[model samples]
Target chain A: MPLRTLLQADDVRRAITRMAHELVEHDPDADRLLLLGIPTRGAVLARRLAAEVARIAGREVPVGVLDVTLYRDDLGTQPTRATGRTDVPADVDGATVVLVDDVLFSGRTVRAALDAVTALGRPAVVRLAVLVDRGHRELPIRPDSVGRNLPSAKSERVRVLLTETDGRDEVTIE
Target chain B: MSDHLLSTRDLSRDAAVALLDVAEDMADTQRRTVKKLPTLRGTTVVNLFFEDSTRTRISFEAAAKRLSADVITFSAKGSSVSKGESLQDTAQTLQAMGADGIVIRHQASGAAAVLATSGWTRAAVVNAGDGTHEHPTQALLDAFTIRKRRFGAGSRGRDLAGLDVVIVGDVLHSRVARSNVWLLTTLGATVRLVAPPTLLPTHIESWPVEAGTDLDAAIADGPDVVMMLRVQRERMTEAFFPSAREYAALYGLSAARADRLRADALVMHPGPMNRGLEIAGSVADSPRSTVLEQVENGIAVRMAVLYDVLAGERTA
Candidate 1:
């Protein structure tokens, strides 16, 4: 399969900076906001977003990692992989949670993340955030904060590589 | 990636590592206030035991419950099996009742294998313990505990490569010993069996492990893990050793021998311990001991096994 560079490192940085600004603009009280990254790359993205939010708001925003593997509906149908860490640093009750992911495609992952988060505690408001919003959503869910909107065919895979996980920041389509 | 985990031999290096990694995730769940996962919400797991077990049974039950699976425990004591019903009958009945997974512990050597292949049920068969043949889950938990203690947080995706493990006790009647020998060896660990001539199994040379009659010699090798098998007093009909005292003198892990072990070396026991006979109480309760951790790891390991069998994608 041939590889295509959808977003370079500078592009990803710009997108993240803009998304962080958008997040700070929407939430005047950033202390009540919690950024939770879905595992693998999402957790890394959440950390990056938290840093960006801290830079803009001048206050630290709590970041947590939520692994949606256990809440996934396609567990038996797809190949089983090892579950990642689901570490919610604090009680999310009455907190506005921004569920962050690297790429938003089918939206099933976000749905699973919702199920996982709901099981932990009741958040006052749960919003979705994605670095790249690739339009192929199957579930009735949409990202509240999107870094980049990249429309592509459903057959093409959108691979998001972060420096923390993949040792480089780039988005690829193959 | 076979649907059924009948023996340790059935697991490849990658599969075993994957199971351990998954168990680590399960262990992570225990730290949370809400330790339940929505993975197997609608699935039903049946604990079918022909033999009496407290730890293994409870571990499986807790594992299944933690994963949000409905659990039904059926022991042979009050069940139809006590009334002369065959294994096939009981299994078929459980299958008819819509069991998604069956964690079976039987006194027969191949009972679990039979259930997995007999077409009596489509549910995944996890062998908790089967006679003197294998206790796959015990070995898995033991491995998990050992790896966790040795490597800490960096234990993920790692095997027991080059680690020396000494399994001491009744190898003849111990399914724990049998399972650990295969699994530890397969994971690239050097395994040595320390037992008396009578306590050792027949044709033991066929096994891929170093056999020795001296406990002190095995301990002097500075093993990373020392796993002591239980010595059942009830199974000692023909006298495997001269007496309990002599067995304790030679093969038993006394306090003195425990002190001689390397500070980092871990002491392990498959539980329901014969306190004074196989391992001294101090050693069993020592800081180096992984007995309690093994029990805790049992739930996570069994959870991983069930998840792999029931929810994991089938391997081609």
Candidate 2:
């Protein structure tokens, strides 16, 4: 595993700040922006995005988590540990949805998450955000916002760490 | 553990209802006299039974055939299960040959739960009946029957909110009773468990139902539905009560007890009834008795379940 410091913790915050402003500009009215974090690391980013969106828009944005365990197309290969509970406070019907995931790899997780979110309610539009973008996508998926890009092998892992969960914002190789 | 339908608690509230909804789609196949679909067309559905079941196995076979799925019926006396191959090994073998789903019935509880969630994720698992644990599809059918009977054409979009359900007889070892308790409660119906103290499970408090030992007191509450569970001869052997006649005299739905219920209150039983034990033959045959309707509803409800789990309504 290569110790590549592509983006420092501070650099990641600035990127999020820019991304948050871009999202606000994309939807000017932005009355109720909904954020759904994919399980584990994505949840941390979802909450952070919500806070950042609030700082820029002068209002608290509603955020939640989506557990896509049952929706996984290729199940049983990975340890399907339940990370935490998902809470959808606002009805996603006709709302702009920003689905946050930690790292984009095969794009299957995002695919499953999209299906699960759709069952909750019909979102007007769905967009994806990633902390780190790792290539080799099995699906035609492109992230709308990215904190940084990491070049990696399939066997290696790009683990996302944040102060909300791991007490420090960093990306580690495993 | 052997794979079987033990309880509804094994299912989440969402999954249970989704299974019921799916069963509805399967029921539609009956409209065609041919009664077959192409969903499980090439897949094999094996019914491995450890206990005697006429309607349950047949109902499942009917369900599989309706789905155009291959059916293999296994008997305890004839199969390797009797020769002592572990259920895990057998399930893995079924997986190898491509069994899309395994509909199993066993004498042990929690068998279905273990199989469905266990590492063998290739096949969809349906629990037919497992020991004193659950008969899920049966309960779903009962609910479907109740909904259709009570609400009619408009029952499709409605959820049972205030329906009073009284379950009478042996709650001790009846898997049907166990399944109904959870499913009914999850669906927002008020469930009353009426049985002898010795017949109630130790964890009855954990169940979201009104539990009492007196049948008269339970029905006196005026439940919209009165379901008499089959008091198995198996329970008599365990000494849950003194005698069948005595139990019937005190707890059974006689001509007099049937009058105690609301006139519209539907009488039900997961059948093969000990008529003289938990319920009188007269009450079971009464027009209000939905015992037969339950059987008819069983097919539709099961079809709905098979389709729901496979259709990926919740999973998709």
Measured by lDDT, the strongest candidate is: 1
Show the lowest summed lDDT stretch of 10 residues, model 2 chain B.
B307-316
Give the per-residue lDDT of model 2 (tens digit) for B1-316.
1132346676665555555554444444354333554444555777877777989999888877776679988777767887898778878878887776688888888787777877764677788988887888888898888887888755654556799999888888888898888888888899988888888889877788888878788878889998888878764566888877788887788989898888898998888887777778898889999989888878877666554444332231
**TM-score for every candidate vs. truth?**
0.93, 0.62
TM-score of chain A of each: 0.96, 0.90
Q: Which ten residues in a row have the lowest lDDT in candidate 1 chain A?
A: A78-87
lDDT of 1 by residue, B117-181 (tens): 89888888999989889999999999999999999999999999999999998989999998998
DockQ of each: 0.60, 0.02
lDDT of each: 0.90, 0.76
Off by over 4 Å in 1: A1-9, A59-64, A87-96, A118-125, A152-156, A161-174, B313-316
Give the alpha carbon lDDT tens digit for every residue of A1-174 in model 2. 566555668877886787777778878786878989987889888888889989989998999987665456653333222223456778888988999998999999998787767766688889898888888899998888877778888988778778888888877765
B196: Cα error in model 2, Å: 1.1
lDDT by residue (tens digit), candidate 1, A1-174: 599999999999999999899888887764689899998889999999999999988888899999989889888787665688777877888888999999999889999999888877788889888999989889899888898999999999999999988999999999
Docking class of 2: incorrect
Error of 1 at B128 (Å): 0.9
